[model samples]
Target chain A: MTGLKLFSRRILPQLVTLAVVVGLISIMFPGFFEISIANGRLYGSPIDILNRGAPVALLAIGMTLVIATGGIDLSVGAVMAICGAMAAWGITEGYGLGLTLLMALAAGLACGLWNGLLVAVLGIQPIVATLILMVAGRGIAQLITEGAILTFNHEGLIFFGSGSLFTIPTPIIIAIVTGALVTLIVRRSALGMLIEAIGINLRASTLAGVNTRVLLIAVYMASGLCAALAGVIAAADIRGADANNAGLWLELDAILAVVIGGTSLLGGRFSLIASLIGALIIQAVNTGILLSGFPPEFNLIIKAGIILIILVLQSPTIRTMVIFLSPAPVSQADTEKQAVNQ
Target chain B: MISKKALVGAGLLASMLMMSSSALAQTVGFSQIGSESGWRAAETTLTLQQAKERGIDLKFADAQQKQENQIKALRSFIAQGVDAILIAPVVATGWDSVLEEAKEAEIPVILLDRMVDSSDDLYLTAVGSDLVHEGSVAGQWLVDELGGKDCNVVELQGTTGSSPAIDRKNGFEQAIEGHANIKLIRSQTGDFTRTKGKEVMESFLKAEDGGKNICALYAHNDDMAVGAIQAIKEAGLKPGEDILVVSIDAVPDIFQAMAAGEANATVELTPNMAGPAFDALAAYMKDGTMPPKFIQTESKLYTQADDPQAVYEQKKDLGY
Candidate 1:
């Protein structure tokens, strides 16, 4: 596919939705997009959106591939908690940053391997397999923290959370680099196509010598690594690891990001860039809610209403209806339809 | 079988010394609602310490935040035929049958920190702090400290619609009533966690012109206060100095913040509910004196002036 066609087909819808949301927010708060540099870091609502969206964005990076492989992970949030607790425990124990991060990432990888073994090896359903970890992972995290918020004061460790390079938050930097690296690793190789083939028809792909089991396990491990990075950033942000609250309900957000990015949950085609945009959209709505000065009670209601609109706008049926109703002169929609058929 | 035989032997020994004063070496079973938080862990520690100080044999059971586990623990306590029982119930309902069984066994049950929905006769008395009064103490401290200054206070509520959150909000509003100088500029729920607390406080700081307009912040709990303290500092303003922070639940971390002059005051929801319960139990055992239906634990306020460092040192080892 040509670059322009790919951009229009995959990324345009999310960009439109994001622009609309940001526009609405700017209307509510005129200074929403105004950026100022203070304390050697970019400070603004837009910057906060990127910074706060980093965890979901990072999770969505791995989630896009997992979802593309026809698998769902409900344990990423719990894994994040466990990983954050691990990092905090290690840091407070006087361990250096490298070892602590390795320990946390290893814990995340172990959790992912457990899920992979249950699903890929034992042939369990992905949802049920991941649900086991989803329930038990928080307990494991609580155990690691000893049912208390484990706090650390290491500045080097905290830089991942609050530190900035060139006025960009470290989390934003981490998310962008990870997204770019993962995109290259998949797009520059046959891995993405293989995962998509397995998602479309596992038996056919396996018969075609695809090595489905190993690939599936590898996808889960990738997810684990992403969740670990997100967890470390979260722990560093607060300077502590709160097992009960860290990354709580964040898996749902990550999944929502993937769905909003126009990725089908049934799996097949995927785009990492689109999912990153989706993550930003979610964060924008959240930050907007905070800035809108609405009562806390209305926060969920407003979010739900806005998300419903965006989902409806992205619906294929709605797009078709729009094409029929408008019948534009240039007929870009018709060409796009032809491209999909081809 | 061994546990049963030992229990019978202990019961026989107790009966043989029925005429003794105060049931001096009495056995009591405590059903704790697991160590879900540092405060809960501290409560468990204080309960054990109280039991040891009273020379009571405390058979402890951790319910692990499950009502069924709590019920099972209470049944085992009943089977053991202990002198009395203490329960920090995980929930308010589904406890009638269990408390009835304890009553039938002639084992008076005292509740700590939380109350049950059963009829009052099921338990002797509940030892807990009045959550609203704790909020009132925190608000009263802020009000008196301001002394009619035009203060724009931001409130960080606990979980939305939780009993503590609702009661604490009401109590604080009640305390600040008629004080036109003390105005509540904004209120939001932080879900009683540090992360949400910091996030909400950051927004409050931004909306209130970078902490210049906000004079005080009242959080429903000290954990949120600690979180908001960091936010205040990050916004390039002093917490206790620029924006006074007063919160409820004097957890150990809050005292550390207080010592650093980062937090202004805190109302302590003491974890020593067992101390009062043990005292009441001792009185009842010595001379069947029926205590009141509800025993309210003191909601003490601590300020920077209260030797916060000493308080922090004292509270650090209580498992908090």
Candidate 2:
């Protein structure tokens, strides 16, 4: 009963939403669920979701933390471009895999530190603080590449993008390991509660000796780190770094995934796993549109329509209405139980 | 007869005017629409090279994609009394006033690579490649390669509803309208990016019997083609062998892919718009002759046979 309660409370809604989206896709293309191994790697629509969703899923993990701290990192997409360019530049210049990865990480951390300084130290609004980097970050990336697509043929670094581990793609493996590690770091220690506490009431949390300022900066740094990893994967995936288009407008997708996962932008409680699932849902819809053979013009419209339906279903009143409208007649006791579950 | 001598006299006057114009190097001003992409950068580099070769004094302005900056540059050129002015307008509208200012100063204006909404009389001539023609070139290449053989093609389009995306799709469809043997089995937008192109192609390979059913791929741009080639390679299928890859915008990377025989062909969206614009301005300066209102640059197609390595070396330095 405890396990059932935990499942219902934590992951059920996101799983249901994912299942519904996958069902809709399979309806459009009957072979959507078929998975086959080719070239010693898993190949199918499902694998595509997890593999393609890796970058955003990683971003969502970091975004969930920042959003929990009542902040947003709009510069993540640009940070991705910067880090990807750095990696591409490094790899092409024969910096080797380890040094390239380290350089990219440092770039990401530096961008995050800058953002944290502006927001936490300077007392600027999170949106305005990150917007500075969001605007100038791609320009910085372009400058690094001298305004071109920096291509690389480094096999060792490219493995992080397309290589697989025992039939699973490398991106999927990286995302899962990162997500699990982040989840353990937060959940295993008092870090999760401190973040939630800060989100709930910053001044009070500070008075309670939560070290709000340092924590806030650390949260933003974590987000930056995630964006850096995502950037490397994206660059490696294409075997080149496209400074202009690498992570264009991807921050919005990460935010949308967080919101769709039922994490409130208003701050407070959050779920890392739920947001990861949200990323997969978004990718599933994208993959579905591709497999559906729809005209390109309808891609955004269809995606928007489905997202609207999902959002509407997520509303508290709509969710309650949906439960009430079900075949099981709800008594007063059941209503109270449902309310308690919510 | 008197009429024959009169014609000779008129010819002498024209020749003298041409000689006088050629004796002095013309000073012209160029306002480019920023280095927004590698292609635009290449256009800028080539424009500078073309000016050097013709011994024209070119005052270049980087407008950075702002109409106001372009307007300021035009006004400055007019003040300096340039021989002619060339502009690649960032946006289509809001050029009437500055163009009129140039007209009042008697400075002939030539538009490059992009069109303005102002009247044709406001500028000397507009030089650009037809985007629709670019698509048709790629499609026509596939049709010729297939040679009436039954084949299936998948297309990776540009951003949804974008002008290039819509026109390129329509143009490809138009070129293959009567070809029953070639079918566009699947079509999707790659948003003119490599990541989306690769992702969409992976799905296409899976859906079409692990790519066994697909015979060719057409991308709206070389970046997408470069990406789709990688996808085809990862699927354990030889890209140029198993499936023909054709795309538009012959960017430098595409040439590298072509050299390696990963990509089959690419239609060049030539960066030489400035070459023709300069020629037209020079012609007008020499004889007061009015060139055509629209000058279409050639949409040259390059294949493996075209020595992709040499082309790559040539374009790599152009900042593309």
Candidate 3:
């Protein structure tokens, strides 16, 4: 497909929604988009949105794959807490930065392997398998931190959360790099097709000699690793591991981002760039609400209203209705192409 | 009423004589809410420390943030025939039956850090800081520190609609009500978390002319204050000097901030709720004095003038 046609077909809807949100925010606060530099780092509301949205964006990258495989991982948030606690514990124990990160990622891998085993080997439902860790993972994290916010002052480790490169925040850079690498790997190899096939029909994909078991485990492990990265960033941002609040209820946000990006929860094709945009949309609304100076009580109501409008605009029924009402006539081939793309 | 006073006086003397014999071996049961936050954890630690200092045979029960578990622990404490019981109830409702049982067992139940919805007479007294008073103390500190300067204040509220949030906001507003020099420019909820606190404060800084317009910040909790402090520093402003930081809940970390001159003042929602409860119990045991229905713990305010580092050291090991 031509780049313009591809952009118009797949990316335009989300981009428009994002633009509208940003436009509304800019209208409310005239300097919403103005970027300034301070302390050798980019500072502005836009940068804040990108920086704050890093965790969700990272999760969305992995979540897109999991959802595309027809499996849900409800344990990312708790995994975040677990990995953060591990990192905090390791740092405080005088471990080097490398060792602390390795331990944290290892913890994530272990959690992912546990969930994978339950789903792939025991034939448990994805939701149930992850639900176990979703509940217990926070407790494990609490134990690791001894039921306190484990504070660390390791500068090397803190750099990931707060340090900047080229005046851009480290978190933004990390998210971009992680997204690009994951996208390249999945698209470069046949792994994407195999995962999509398994999602479409697990029995058929298994009969077709796709290593469904190993692929399932690998997919969950990827999700776990992404969650660990998010956890580290969150912990590093605050310089502490808050077992109770770290990544609490963020799995839902990641899932919402995936759904808002036009990916089906029932499984099939997925788009990482769209999901990243959806994460940004969520953060933009958040930043807008904060800047609007509305009462705290109205925050949720306003966010819910804006998100509802965005979803309604993205609804397929409304899209078709808009097409039907359009002045321009669409050829049969173009209409068929639109349907297949969706 | 005069005759009743005489009769109570007589009863007091009679109980005092009987209580002195067993005073050294007094046993108490403490039912604590789970360590949900640093403050709650500190309360648990202080309770244990208080029990140990008094040489009281203390049986500690963790309710795990469940009303059911608290009720169960209360029943078991009553069955054990403890002299007095201290409970930090997880919730207000569903305590009528449990309190009634404790009363029937002749055990004085003193609530720690939280109150129950049962009749006042059901329990001896509830010892907790006045949430509104805590907020007002924080606000009053800001008002005094501003010294009639035309200062714009930004508030970091707790979870929306929470009792502490509402009461703290009200108390602060009440404190600065007549101060025309002070104005609340913006207010938002940070959900009482560091992450949300930092994120919300960043937007506040952006909206308020990059932290120049705002002169003070009031957070409902110290954690949020700490987060906002970071946001202020990131915006290239000195937190304590450029914008005064005042918040409630003197968690250990806040003292660290204060020692570093990053935070200005904090109103302590003192976790030593058990200290007063135990004192009242001791007084009641020594003489048949009925403690007040409610005991308001002190909402002490700490500023940079105070020895914040010493306080931090004292509180650091308290599990906060």
Candidate 4:
């Protein structure tokens, strides 16, 4: 009984909510369970959703960490663009794949360092600091590509986009692996505790010897690297480098995913697994809309509605109701009291 | 000494008259929609070059793809009292008021590359390609290739509510009206971005189960087509072979794709819309006689057999 209560307190509410939503969608779309898994590959339209969801999922994982630290990285999409342009340029210049990937990683790290320095060291607002990079990174990308699409003859990169590893899409595998790594870092490491502490109270954490500045910088750097990885995957998928549209509006999607996963925009709380599920939900909704023969314009309206619904459900009032209805009572009250105490 | 001073004063007066006459020669105020695309860039470059060659004092303002900025520049030009005005509108709507303002100032306005929505005839003439015809050309080519066989197609639309999107779709649909063989199975806006185009195409592929049953892909522009090709290839289908791809813009990448046999056909919406545009502007400057309400540029269909390599070589020379 105690174990069940603990489980309910920790994860049951989110799982139940997710189940209810998925059940409703499945009811509406009869073929939702008819996903074809041939030779270990999930065929049908869902694969596209999973594929398209990869980069956004990667970005949301990083954004979740940064938001948990009470910071925002607005330059993630631009970093993706810059990294893609650089990778494409390098490949076109006959650089080896390993070197090009390294260059992309280094560029992302440099951008993150610049943003981190402004926010953590210089005491600038996170939004303002990242916004500068958001604007300048795009300009840098354009400069790298000379405002043109850089086409390359790299077969290895193309394979990363289209080839399957043990019947799973490479991008999907990468996203899953990255998600696991991030979850481990956040759930098992001391850094995660420090981030959460700093997010909750920056001054208190500094006095507590948490090295808040270093944590802030580290979070942004991770976000940059995640965005760069996404860029490489995207470039590999397309077999071309398009600076203009490489990562356009990805930041918005990442923010939305994090928010939907019960991460507070104001920070101090986060869920890596929940964020992954949220990203999946968003991707599924997009795929559902497309498969249902609706016009693509309706996607914006539907996505906005989903975010609103999720946020409203996460509100304290609804959360209280959800807690009361979960068939267990004492632990729910304890968690509520603990939250109130915090 | 008195005679020398009198001569000097006369010479000074002559020089001032010459300056005034030169300044008044032909000041053409041009408010350009900033560099949004390669075509727009080429148009601007050609317009400036032509203006310089003709000794027309081109008072240029780049609106940077904003209607508000263009309107502000236009008002500034009006205040400066230039001889004539040229505008390349970013959109087809919301121009009646500003155009009326220009009209009230007695400056003739000429539209370039795109048209305005209002029927006010506020502008002298619009110099652009026949956008509807460009779409029709693509549709007709697809029809010929299909040879009266049933075919499923997916369309990659341009920006929603834009003139190109509306007109191109209309033209393509009109051409394919009686042809019961060709059907557009799925149509969605790619927002004219390569990424969005690929996203939409991925969905299309998934829904269609990565099959060659999808007859052809039609795009409003080459960038979207290129994106669709990527998605098609990713789905393990040969783009130009399994699914015939057609689009409007004959961009350099499109030619390269064609040369590589990854793209099948495209209608040339020449980026050099500037040549005819300047010719019309010069005629108007020479004599206040206005040209046609819409000056249509010529468009041609480019096919794989048309020697894309040669065309690529030629376009490189043309600074594409």
Candidate 5:
């Protein structure tokens, strides 16, 4: 009974939003849900959403934890650029595939460490702290590629971009595995509650013997690691590292996914699966717009309208109003649920 | 060994004397927008090569995409009393005061690649390719290739609301207008990047009956076309054969794709804007020949017959 209640209260909204988006796209294009085996892989609009949504989903995984601690990551996109650049440079310079990935991962970890130090040690605001890398990370990436889209023909590195495993796309595989690992590390330990405690009152949590600084740094490192993986996948997908464009402006999408997942920006409880679904919802809308045959000018306006509706529906007052407008018996039980929720 | 050294020293001295005697080599200062794109970098390289070929002394300044830095560079060029000034203004406005200063110094300024909103008399001439014309060239080639066969085309447009996206889309549509056989079935913004191009094309393929309905693919730029070509291949379709590919911008990678027969056509957005600018400047400096206010560069088209392999080899190291 508790599990059922938790699913209905915590994850139901995001799951319903994703279903509606997919259903809407199917209505717009009759062939939206048609999946078939092509080139030994599941090929369809849904797969494309998961495949294309991989980077944002992975970022959302790290972003959920950070937001759960009352922090934000503006540098993940830039860090992705840096890591992609590092991977490309390593591959071209003959460092091989394994070393190249390690190099990219190390670059991401270093960027995260720098960001963590600024926010945790120096006591800078999260936005301002990450903004430094947000501005400079691309410049550093450009330097690595020497102001060009660094292309490589290494088969090993390219496998990470678009390769499949057991008929599943590599990017989707990476996203799911990383998301699950992060979920386990956070939920299966005291880290989850500690993060929430810090968000509610940082000084109080610190006084209560939470190693706030180390935990903060670890959270940032995880975000950086996720970004690095995203960067590798982006570069691998295109078979090159485009320093100017790799994961450009995707941090906002990650934040939006977390928000749409019903995670509060003020930081508290977070659900990894909900954020992942939020990312899929965004991708479904993007793919739907492409298949709608509408003019390009209508793209952003339609997306904005849909997102506005979703947020309005996610509002607590709106939910309560919706329940009140529903059957009378349901409203009485919903008020009790709301009471428990508070 | 000493005699050999003396001979080499004498040869070097003779070359130095000859170089100094050619003091008539005009000194021109070029104020360039920063290396923002691969095309811009190629343009800079070609500009330096053009100056060298003409025995002209060129002073170059990169403004790093800032208008203030450009103004400073222009002031310094004027102070150095250069023979002429060439500027690729990053923006179209805020050049009136600087142009007035250059005009007062009696130094003729030529605009390259991009234009300024300043008065016509402020600069001698502006040299650039017609972006719309480039798009029309790509479209015209497709029309000529298909010969009125009924076809469904998919378009991968550039970044939304960008000038190139707008102008290129207009030009292509205009060229294909009144053609009953060629219909553009679907079009979407690819954000003018390879990754977005591939992703959008994937969605396009899924929407268009596994790409069987798409007879040809038109991209606003070569990068997108290159990416779309890959997507078509991944969909188990030969890009050049099944869906004819036409795009603008003759970047080196696109040439390589053409060499592999994966891409069909590209219209060149030549990076040699400085070549024509130099010619006009030379004429203006000599015998009071004032070039026209706007000099448009050629938008040459390339096909499979154009020896794309040789072209690729030539352009591979131009900093592209």
Candidate 6:
């Protein structure tokens, strides 16, 4: 009974969401469940759900960490755009794949460091600091491309986008591996505790000798790396870099996924698995909308409605009401004893 | 103190005398959509340059692609008592009330690069490419190339609620109507970005069985088509050969792509619609000559047969 209650408290929301999505998709498409597994691979449209979910999953992983520290990074999408443009520019300028990848990663790290300096040293608000980068990054991307779409003749880069290992897409593989590493870091390292402390009580944590500034910067830097990796995969898939629309409006979806995964925007807790599940749920919803014969415009309304429903479920008042509405009652003798002890 | 007062009185008298002798230049207020695309940047630069050359006092305001900001700028322009107004609307709808205000102010308005959905006839003329014609030319070229054979095509659309997206789709459908063999298996808006174009094409590739059946692609603009070409190449198929591609807007990169045999063809939508636009605006300003409602620009289709290097040079000269 205790285990069941704990699961309900910790994991039930994601599970319920998964069930609802599965039910809806299965009902709408008759053959959704019939998957053929051949040569150690599962073949179907489900592969697309996983593939499309990868970039958002990467962003959500980083966003979950930042939100746990009571901060937000609104510039991930722009960072991705800049990184993509840089990679494409590098490759087109006759640089090898290794150099291009290194440059892209370095650009992302530099952007994060810039954001960290503003937020940690200069005392700018996280949103304001990142927002400046968000506005400037796209401009920088345009400058690099000269407002032109750049195509490269690099095969190794294309492989990252289209190649598969054991029949699994490279992007999906990267997402899963990166997600595991992030999960391990947050679960096993002292950094997670420090972040939680800072979020819960900043003054007290600083007094307790927690390096709040460094942790905050690290979180943002990690977010930058994640966004950069997503950019590489995206650019690789496209085999080109487009400054105009690469990673556009992606930050919104990342934030939504993090919030839906049960991380409080106000800070203090995060669930990596839940966040991944949140990314999957959103992708599934999008695919479901496409397969349901509804026009694409309805997808926005459906996403907004789902987010609202999840937020309502997270309300403290609703949880309390649900608890009170249960048929089981607490023992009065124990309550009286507890009162006397107090 | 007496000397200082005499000097101030002399300066005021001199300014008043100068003001009385000189006529105030006609001010043309312009509300531009933000510099989101290369074409938008070029248009803004041309408008400013032409205004300066013609000695028109152009008060420019950028809306950063927001309708509210454009409306605010227009109201301010009206308040400033400008003689004329110009607007490049971000979206086609929601301009009735604001345009009515401009009409009440008796200011002649010109639409540039885009059109609004107001029935008030407040604007003098729209100067832009026939977007539908551009799309039809692309479609007609593809039809001629395919020779009415069965071909599956995918499309990358532009931003929704925009006039170009609606008109381009309509025109393409009209051209491909009787050609039943050219089938559009997948169509979605890439919002006129290279990334979304690539992303949507990626999904299309994954959904289809190895993307072997996709015969051709059509994009509302060249940027998305270029992105689609990337996707096609990444899928291990030749772009221009295995899958013929066509799009509107002969951006320089499209020419480069065509030169490299990655893209098949594109219809030209010259970004230099400014010259003729200013000509019409000048007439309206000088003599109150109401120009025709639609001033259409010519569009041409460019294929691999055309020397891309020469086309590139010509387009670069046109400030593309």
On DockQ, the leading prediction is 3
Q: Per-residue lDDT for A19-96 in model 6, tens only?
A: 788688879776555544333444445776787789889999888888888888999999888888889999888788
- What tens digits encode model 6's per-residue C-alpha lDDT throughout B5-76? 564356346534543443476577788887776667667777877777777667777786789878887887
User: On residues A65-155, what C-alpha lDDT tens digit does candidate 3 reach at each position?
Assistant: 8888899999999999999999999999999999999999999989889988898889899999999999999999999999899998899
- Arrange candidates by DockQ, highest first: which order? 3, 5, 2, 1, 4, 6
RMSD of each: 3.8, 8.1, 6.9, 7.2, 6.0, 7.7
Candidate 6: lDDT of B207?
Answer: 50
Worst 10 residues of 2 chain A by lDDT: A324-333
Predictions' DockQ, in order: 0.52, 0.64, 0.70, 0.29, 0.65, 0.19
Q: How well docked is model 3, in DockQ terms? A: 0.70
Model 5 chain B: weakest 10-residue lDDT segment is: B7-16
Check candidate 3 and list the clashing pairs.
Answer: none
Per-residue lDDT of model 2, residues B64-180, tens digit only: 777887887788778867788999999999999999999999999999988988899999999998999988988899899899999999999898878899889888998898999
**lDDT of each residue in B269-312, candidate 5, tens digit only:** 99998889889887877788988899999999999999999999
Among these predictions, the greatest TM-score belongs to: 5
In angstroms, how far off is B110's CA in candidate 6? 6.9
Tell me how candidate 5 scores on lDDT: 0.90
Candidate 5, what DockQ? 0.65
Provide the lDDT at A182 for model 2: 96
Query: How does each model score on TM-score?
Result: 0.94, 0.94, 0.94, 0.84, 0.95, 0.75
State the TM-score of candidate 6 restricted to chain B. 0.76
Candidate 5, position B271, lDDT: 91
Please tell me how candidate 6 rates in CAPRI terms: incorrect
Q: What is the lDDT of residue B310 in candidate 5?
A: 98
